[model samples]
Target: MKTAIYEKAGKITVAEIEKPSLQAKDDVIIKVVRACVCGSDLWRYDENVPHEHGDANSGHEAIGIVEEVGEDITTLVPGDFVIVPFTHGCGHCDACRTGFDGTCDNHPGYQNFGNNYQSQYIRFHYGNWALVKVPGQPSDYSEGMIKSLLTLADVMPTGYHAARVADVKPGDKIVVIGDGAVGQCAVIAAKMRGASQIIMMSRHADRQQMALESGATAVVAERGEEGIAKVREILGGGADAALECVGTEASIDQALGVLHNGGRIGFVGVPHYSNHALGSTFSTNIIIGGGAASVTTYVKDFLLDAVLKGQINPGRVFTQTYSLDNIDQAYKDMANRKTIKAMVTVD
Candidate 1:
């Protein structure tokens, strides 16, 4: 089997590796059909985080067909089409019982999280909790629909998590900071919540267009202070709430900058700001909430119907696609800002 591994900053490589099989009674083997290059993966690619020189599995987003399930598993069977979420919880944990899968204490952080899915196979250690069955068989969906379903594995739910945290309400005016796939989905999420006005802070032409397609009513093309100014001017002051999708110090500042007094801010991007950056929110009186979303616990059901019924098409964010072996190109294009979401289709 061939797998994608992190080589160093700005590089990834395909290497021959042993094929994976079920190792636990609860595990299931999946034949991966598609994988995504997520924004967080870039943290290692760009060396924003520690990167030791080693060949190891490195993908968290994938869709696959079940090949085998361990004896203890009953929720899935061979030939079932499933989407693998990035996180899973042990059903018996206090957090799990309370629906905080992201903060699960009893179970592992994520099944297959320690391995890469860019290969042909993946072993899901917690099959029952890790896999979500698509509503219909593969034949019932188009290639595009499958791609849309893939977003449910992470970004789609992440954006929705932001909306939920911010308490985006009917007729509320909202601004989504950033224009990545997650940002675009936040726009769609705000719309789904019945927000009357959605502003997307976007700098790229392609992403701006996608934001509109995703339900953003206004697109602010400027960045930095100029971007904040545009959003304020358009909303006639700051928006009622803001969803921060870009995980950067600048984006956090911008999210806070474009909010009304007492407004809510849902921050779903991975945290990258200093303590001072976090404390600065207090002076504004805005309610700050959000972190790693427990999407596995809350969002899968909320989005499955929307994705299947054609009400939301988050797949539009996957502007480019690559073959599994060409995975390096996918990461490179995303790092270079040439793609909104980089998708890879497997055989």
Candidate 2:
């Protein structure tokens, strides 16, 4: 099997690796059908980041057909199509019970699947609690459509998680900082939740257009203090909720500055220690929350329904697609910002 490996900082390669086999009772073997490069993956590829060490499997968002299942797995079987959730967690863990699967302590070893770690334990969730059954579909749906839904495995649900954390409500005015796929997905999710006005803060024309199509009522192409002022000007004061999808100090400050008193900010972007100020957030009385999205929690039910109903089209974010062997180009395009999201076809 050829897997994308992060050989070291600033390096990536497609290498022939042993295929993963079923090793746990709850595990299932999936033949990768589609996968995409994530923003976090890019950070890990950076040589400057200390934690970006070691060779690891490069993707977490993927969909595939189940080739085999462990003995105790009764609900899924071979040939079942499924989406791989980004976070693996034990179903019965207290954190998972509370809908915080990303923090699950008992999650099995799928993490090792990507890394060159020799430990037998899966580094991430390989089978215990990170996979979801892709909704069975009618033959009428096109392959492109199915591939589009796979985006929900991470970005879409992640955006939705931002909204959930902010407690977006019907008739509330929402502002989103960042125009990445996650931000666009946040726009759509806010609309679905009944936000009366959705404002997208972005500097890129292409991303601004995408934000509009995704359900943003307006777009602001400003940065720093100016952007925050624009958001308040449009909302008549401040937005009821703000979502920060770009994990940068500027974006986080912009999201926080535009929120009305007592409002909340939900951040989905992976933050670095230097990028955010916890003390400031605490003093502002602004509620802050969000981390790795509990994608599996929503993957099977809410996300699948939204896609099947045609209410959300996250696939629009994928401006480019490549073959598995052309994975290098996919990363380059994303790194250069020449593409919004890049999809890699494994078949």
Candidate 3:
């Protein structure tokens, strides 16, 4: 099997690695079908955070079919199509019971899964907590569209998490402060949550148009104070809720500045080392919260319905596709912003 490996700091390579097997009773072996490059993956690619000691596998968002299952894995079996949830958590854990699976105690890692035989430091493991099976396909959808289910593994639920955390409501004005896939998805999520007027902030014309297509009622092509002012001018005052999808000091600040005194802000971007101040928000009484989306909690039914119902086509975000052999190009195009999202086909 060829797996993408973080060869060294700021470098990656497709290396021949042994395939993964079921090592736990609740585990299932999946033949990965489609996977996408996430913005967070860029952090590792750029060496912003040291790679986990054994995370040679270059991605977390993926969809596939079950190839095999452990003895106790009764809910799924061979031939079951499933989405691989990015966060690992035991369904019964205290955090999981409260719907926060990203912090699962029994989640798989090198320390818990044991080292791989080929690479003594490599750890690869899967638990029931990381997989969700999709049922019978609806009559109106195609098999190709089914591959888009991979988005539900992370970005779809993540976008919804951003909107939900902000407490966006019907007739409320909202602004999304990113136009990447997650950000565009946030536009769709905000609309689905019943936000009457939604504004998307993006400098790129292509993405601005995409935001409109996704459901944003307006698009602002500015940053900093100028951007906030544009949003305020359009909405009469400030937005009731703001969603931050870009993990940058500029993006976060824009989200805060564009909200009304009692507004709420939801952020799902992976923060860098720079400090993003909340002091200004304090005086405004704005509520702020959001982190790694608890994707596992929402993958069970809600995400499936949104996809099956044709209410949203999050997969349209994948503007470029690459074969597994051309994974390098996928990363290059994404880093250069030439592609909104890159999809890698394993088969």
Candidate 4:
């Protein structure tokens, strides 16, 4: 099998490796059909530390066909096509039952599934609840529809998590802080939740345009206080809610700065900011919420129908595509901002 390896800072390459096999009774071996480079993968690309090279930790977001199923897996079988959420959990765990499957108690840390998704095949554990079954095989859908299904694996659910945590409501004004794939999805989420005004903060023309197409009522290209002021000007005051999709100090500050005194904030970024940056929210009545998205919860509960019905096109955020052989270039283009998001087709 061919797999993606994170060698070190500024280098991600494809290498030939052993194919995964079932190690647990609840495990499943998937033939990866679609996968993509995530923004968090780029963060790892820039890290100076020696990367962990193995099947246990690879690319996270993917949708694939079940080539084999474990003995304990009753709900799924070989030939079932499924969306593999980045996080897996035991279905009966308290966290999983409550829609926070990302923080499942039984499968804490990286113990659940080996998210080696950027490959020809990968192993997935906790099979009963973690995998969301698609209607048919990869050949059943168009290239674009398949891409939209892939987003449900991570980015789309993550974006919707931001809006859900922030409690976005009908007629509310909301500001999205980042313009990455997750941020772009957040715009769609805000609109889906009935937010009347959606302000997307982005400097790039291409991402700004995508934001508009995704449901952003306005765009603010400036950063820092200038951007905050612009968003306020567009909304005619601070917004009712702000969605923080970038996990940097500057982005966090931008989210906080664009909110009303009693507003709420939902953050789904990878959390690079410090506590001091969030301390200012105490003075105002702002409510802060959000964490790693419960991907299975949202997909099963809400967003899947929307995607299948063609009500939203979150897949447009995938501005570029590549083959598994050219995944190295996919990472580079996303890191360089030459593409909004990159998708890899492995069928």
RMSD of each: 2.1, 3.4, 3.9, 1.6
TM-score of candidate 4 against the unseen true structure: 0.96
lDDT of 4 by residue, 166-275 (tens): 99999999999889999999999999999999998888999999999888998988899898889888999999999999999898888888998999999999789785
TM-score per candidate, chains pooled: 0.93, 0.90, 0.89, 0.96
The local distance difference test score of each candidate is 0.82, 0.76, 0.76, 0.88
Write the number of the candidate with greater TM-score, choosing between 1 and 2. Answer: 1
Residues 1-347, candidate 1, lDDT per residue (tens digit)? 77888887777888777888888999888888889898888877877555665545577788888999999998888989898777766666887676666657766545335657777888876778757888556667887898898898888988988998899999999999978888988999999999999998877888888888878898888878898888889988888899999878888788888888899999988888874555666777899888666657655557888888889998888889999889999999998999889998877
lDDT of 2 by residue, 226-260 (tens): 88888888889988899889888787788888988
Enumerate clash totals for all models, in the order shown: 0, 12, 0, 0
- Could you tell which candidate, 1 or 4, scores higher by lDDT? 4
Which residue segments of model 4 deviate by more than 4 Å? 52-56, 111-113, 275-280
Candidate 3 lDDT for residue 33: 72
Residues 91-157 of candidate 3 have per-residue lDDT tens digits of: 7878678776755665633222232211111122445555677775222347447545768877888
Sorted by lDDT, highest first, which candidate order results? 4, 1, 2, 3
- Report residue 148 deviation for candidate 3 (angstroms): 3.1
